[model samples]
Target: MHQAALLGGMIHDASHYGWKVAQPPHDWRKMAEAVQNHVKSLNWGHRVQLQDRKVKYFNFKASFVNPHMVCGVSKGGEETLLSADHIVIATGGRPRYPTHIEGALEYGITSDDIFWLKESPGKTLVVGASYVALECAGFLTGLGLDTTVMIRSVPLRAFDQQMASLVTEHMAVHGTRILRGCTPLRVERLSDGRLQVTWVDLASDKKDTGTFDTVLWAVGKP
Candidate 1:
């Protein structure tokens, strides 16, 4: 994802008039394709494979049958039961959406979608204070996109506050607009293909609004 942003920055620089020698215009479609291909390569061995080793891997829907037994259902609807001395669950998580906010799920994307975007998300508004939120906003700003991060409270609540401040400060120094102590109230789509967001500053108890091409929700993973 960072590579994608770097590629975008290079493209922007080459196209800007300040360059002494003009370079060929960047092909967004080609860049997007390259990013997708690279992502696919990274997942080449995602599936577990078994060969000469005793370890076994299964690609199916798994459920706990007992404390030491599991049942798996394959794509063909075949069921397999296996027993072991120990069991481990390693399934990851998905991004959490602000369900209480109007138009959140229907209009917003998550970190999962950003890497897979075929085109740039222009003038992005990233909502959250998690590391994921800051990272996404950082990349977007690095790529020369108009990016903003709205933090409802302290940034990176789970991490060291001082280090988190430095991270956010660096991002701000690089051009990411930071809105602290603010929470989004709602999001609405404009006819011109932009997102209009309404939010409130908790400290001031005042409302504000902004428009962006994309609204990303990165509150956290639950």
Candidate 2:
């Protein structure tokens, strides 16, 4: 997704290198299909490597029955019990959603689903201050979409704060709108099929509303 965004800048730079080419239109569907297909190919490669290593693969939902025993349930509802000398749990975190906000889960998406979207999320509101949030906003802006970021506090909170400011400033100078010290209160679907986001300004305690084609939450992950 980020690479897709950089293609535009590269086109602009082409003139400096004597490649006088016109700025071409971006095809979201084509880029999305290519990315998805590449990801699927990588997954297939991993499966093949595992198979060649003589590893038994089970596509199942597993639950620990005891310290050494596990119960696995398949998609078709078949269950099996397996015992091993050792058990290793390796679950990864996923993007978190603010379920308390009205219509959040129903109307909004996250970093996980944005790239997978078949259609472009026209005008977007990205909520949160993490690097993930900024990266998404930057790419969307680079793709020539109307993108705004609603930040509750400092962006890149865990990283170097001074550098974070520079990163955000660069984005702002390049055309991304940054809404600081604000948090979303609710998300509602509008009559025209757009999303209406209501947010509050932390400093003024004032509420405001804006409509967008998509709302993305990048708050954090558990």
Candidate 3:
């Protein structure tokens, strides 16, 4: 659910029919608004819990909500029988940050967090060589910020060479500095809370240097 467009969001599986149902294209902002509205539509509804503090390593207890013991299966050695018309496990995959990079956890911002940003960053450094990384870099640069993309190898390494080169060129032409073949070493916060990025340029054999108000780690996603 990404790559949103101005009129309608990017369409996924639009050509597929029968086995593959097509979902109508939607505006990203409008989709977000709709989700918020749907959530608000529920009044007192089901039990909801808000945890202010981060989870401090706890095991979850399994309590069946359905009464009828139709679906008989004790996978985790559950003492109680579980039954329901249908079970839906919507626990989706979450993006993870690379542990090798220093200060990434501290200064790093992900796609989940970037949407809530009230003030656009003065400068943004995106770390990845993938499509998402490139798209984010372009978006930030279009918003009138000094955006830089640092990739361990050539930008868009996974795509066709010629097409990737074209996109890389276009990004640079649009004012998004592309730093390919650079591996981020650390992300240090200055006194002003800005990120001072350090890296190594594999191609040039020189110390890579970068600074930005925000550091977006777009290094691959699930």
Candidate 4:
């Protein structure tokens, strides 16, 4: 994920200064493949062990049956029960969308989808001020995309204010647009495949609108 950002920054700087460089246009498909391959390479040993039947991997949704037992349901609706000495809860989480925002779930994508996108998110509006939001916005901006970060209150509220300010300032110094004190109201899709977003400035109670190719909800994971 960070490598994408680094490559984007380098490309952005080169293009900004009009450097004569030979490089392919930012292709999300190619990037996604590269990322997946890199990850697979890093876990080759584990994959080999699983393939050799030395380890068992279950790709299913699991629930506890009792203190010493567990049940898992596979995608095909097959159930398997097993007893273990100890069970570990390692299931990961996903991004959360604002349920109150109209058309949010239907029209917007989350951070989870960004990394796997097959096409470039041309112009993006990332809602939230968390590290995930900032990091994504940073990379999108560096990739020469018109990237904006919308903050309802402050940036990186969970971290030190001074450091957070620095991070936002740095992003601003780059090409990332920052919208502070603003909260999204709704998202609507245009006929031409673009998204029209409506938001409000909390301080002034003023409403605004913007069109973007992507609306990413980076409001933190549940």
Candidate 5:
């Protein structure tokens, strides 16, 4: 996903600064295809399937052994140990919804779920200003969805102000609709599988509601 962003025009103004760097833009889809082929080469057991649950810890017994590095994995009904001299714990972070918002999970879709979408969204209102938000909105809009970015304060608040502003401007010119100074309250699911977003504009004591195909949360992502 990080590589996808680099190829999707995030590298234009990002390369000059010493902050973040990306290679010269190339065919992102091609890169992704190449990666997929490489992964297929390994012929690693069955494709890893998710049960949509949290992994509390590594159930390491360090006993069961195999010939390859990933000797064993948690699959079927077994937690067989893999044979290796060193094991790296690369389990990444978890999804965290906004504290004030309710039913985010009920109506919202996390980054993990976005890639597997079967249909393209007609409209997407992405919430949050972090890098996740920026990249997701950019990707969605680039794919021809009407993407609206909503932020409570400023987008990319953690980054340097200048770079963040540059990203914001680039996104605007490319067709991403950015709505600043707003936060989502809840996502209301419609019968048609679309979502109705209820958001509070921080600048004004008013509420706004709109229908969207999906709502992406990128606010201070955990």
Candidate 6:
């Protein structure tokens, strides 16, 4: 998805080198389908690799029955208890949603679903200050879309402040609107199916509203 946006800029830069090229319109659907297919291929490859190693893979929800035993339930209510010499549990965190906001969960999408979108997300409003948030906004802007980022406080808050400043500055110079010290209060669907976002300025305690085609949440995971 990131590469998809970079291609546009590369094409434009090529023109400066005396290359006769016209920037073609981006086809969001085509790019999304390609990305999705690539991910599916990777998944299939993983399963094949495990099979080659003579490993049994189960598509089930697993719970620890004991230190060496586990209970797994499949989609159709088939339950099985398997015991092994050792056990390992790997848990990856998931993105957090702002459920306190009236309509955030219902109207906003997380980074996980952004790349799988079927259509272009026009005039997008991205929420959060993590690298994921900045990177997503950056690519969306590079694709010639209207992009805005709403940061509750400083951007890249967990990273080095100086380097984070440089990144945010670069994004601002390249057409990404950065709303500092602000937070979204709610999201609503307008009559035209566009999203209406209401936010508040932390410093002034003032409320403002804007309309967008999509709202993306990139807040950290729990």
Native-to-model Cα distance after best TM-score fit, residue 10 in candidate 2, in Å? 1.8
Tens-place lDDT per residue, model 1, 108-152, is 999998877778888999999988999999888876779999999
Which of the two, 1 or 5, has more lDDT? 1
Taking the tens digit of each residue's C-alpha lDDT, what string does model 5 give over 48-78? 3222344234444333344435534444545
* True lDDT of residue 150, candidate 4: 95
**Alpha carbon lDDT of each predicted model:** 0.86, 0.93, 0.68, 0.89, 0.70, 0.93
Q: What's the lDDT for candidate 5? A: 0.70
Ranking of candidates on TM-score, top first:
2, 6, 4, 1, 5, 3
**Per-residue lDDT for 1-222 in model 4, tens only?**
567768866765696787976665677778788877877787887778797986688777888899999998999999999889988876779999998999899999998888777788899999999999999998887777899999998888879999999999999999899999999999999999999999999999999999999999999877
Cα deviation of 97 in candidate 1 (Å)?
1.3
* Order of the predicted models by lDDT, top scorer first: 6, 2, 4, 1, 5, 3
**Candidate 4: pairs in clash:** none
Clashes of each: 0, 0, 0, 0, 0, 0
Model 3 CA lDDT for position 99: 71
Which 10 successive residues of model 5 have the least lDDT summed?
43-52
- Ten-residue stretch with the least lDDT total in model 6: 87-96
Stretches of candidate 2 exceeding 4 Å from the true structure: 15-20
How many clashes would you count in candidate 4?
0
lDDT of 6 by residue, 99-200 (tens): 999898999999998889999999999999999999999999889889999999999988999999999999999899999999999999999999999999
Q: What TM-score would each prediction reach against the true structure? A: 0.81, 0.94, 0.62, 0.87, 0.64, 0.93
lDDT of 3: 0.68
lDDT (Cα, 0-100) at 82 in candidate 3: 53
lDDT of 2 at 69: 98
